[model samples]
Target: MYNPTVARLTYRALLGRRRALILFALPALLILMSVVVRMFVGVDDRVAAEVLGGFALATMVPLIGVIAGTGAIGPEIDDGSIVYLLSKPVKRSEIIITKLFVAVAVTMAFSAIPTFVAGWILNGNGQQIAIAYTVAALVASIAYSALFLLLGTVSRHAVVIGLVYALGWEALFGSLVAGARTLSVQQWSLAVAERIGTGDEITSDVGLPLATTLLVAVSVAATWYASQKLRTLTLAGEE
Candidate 1:
């Protein structure tokens, strides 16, 4: 269920000079930090969880998601290039689906792979910690892509709004308020990691069943809503 042309365009748009620098920078920082931490602290599971959870999962993933997801459609819509695609015979849903796929792939590649490498650097995959957090990064990528894709479709300020949600809400409020954890993408993804990792170092506020349900529901609903928005998209005349 992919359109190759749309996918290619989306990939190019996302991997352009500036955005690619941003996408690569965070993961590189994460790996660098992992190496430094390993040198200083030696291999410890607690340190591994803290680094992965605090920086990789909390900061890097959402930032990359915001860039990739909003970048997939926001620029096209802003520059009026989307009108050419809209005027075509292709289904609106196909365009959204293809772009969504591209965004998810980019997010996973930039975020998850580095997370795995960082985890390994931290503990050599001891107690399955590296693999567990890698799985969390993978799961988080899907939900973040769909949600930010919908934001890109509906708002010109998609990146700002995404940062607010990712940083202000998910990080700040989720730490301050206990109830906020239940509604967090980070927590839901952590739930998956918790189940996979044997150690108690990695944990989540949400349960497995509830987390899985929320993950699936958010991804499906966001994609559906984005496709619907695309179907009804309007182009304004330049006065």
Candidate 2:
């Protein structure tokens, strides 16, 4: 249920000047941080792991996900423009899926690519750390896109809610609360990365099997729910 037109429009809005600035900002910072760390700290595998894992994976990925995911549909919904899209011939599900696809693409581009570059810069791909965390960023992108796109459909305050969840719950509480870590997208992605990484430094609280299952489940469930929400918006459009 893909729609090219829906995808094009979603891409335009997300990559528009303001949103593009936010999307690019983190990746730039990550690269700069990598350069700074490299110049000052020199090449140490542990330091590389600390920078990429602590800042890149933990902070950058989720924040970019929040921006890309929410910006995909939130603006359209907020300004009543979604009614125009809803009134079109496209099915509600197609619209939701298309937006989800765009969101995932943007998140991956802004996050996964830079993560690899930064990883390379940090340690010249030592211990496969660059590849490992890049894999994590890619996996994390899909789940975050679906989850935050669903948020866009349901809440006008989706961005705010996402920020709180990303910075507060994820980056903070996830480290402290064992239960919170289990439910986290970050942890789930890290599980996959843990396998790819050679050294013992890369770790995850959740096992790979459990992480894969949860990632797939969350992405599918969120996309399905967002489609349902848009179907109701179809009726709202007709009114």
**Against the true structure, what is each candidate's TM-score?**
0.97, 0.98
lDDT of 2 by residue, 1-239 (tens): 89999999989999999988888999999999999999998988889888888888888999999998999999989999888887778888888898999999999999999999999999999999999999999999999999999999999999999999989877887756898999999899999999999998798999999999999999999999999998887776677
Candidate lDDT (C-alpha), each? 0.92, 0.92
Candidate 2 Cα outliers beyond 4 Å, as residue runs: none
Residue-wise lDDT of candidate 1 within 4-80, one digit each (tens)?
Answer: 99999999999999999999999999999999999999999999999999889888888899999999999998898
Whole-model alpha-carbon lDDT for candidate 2 = 0.92
| Global fold similarity of model 2 (TM-score) | 0.98
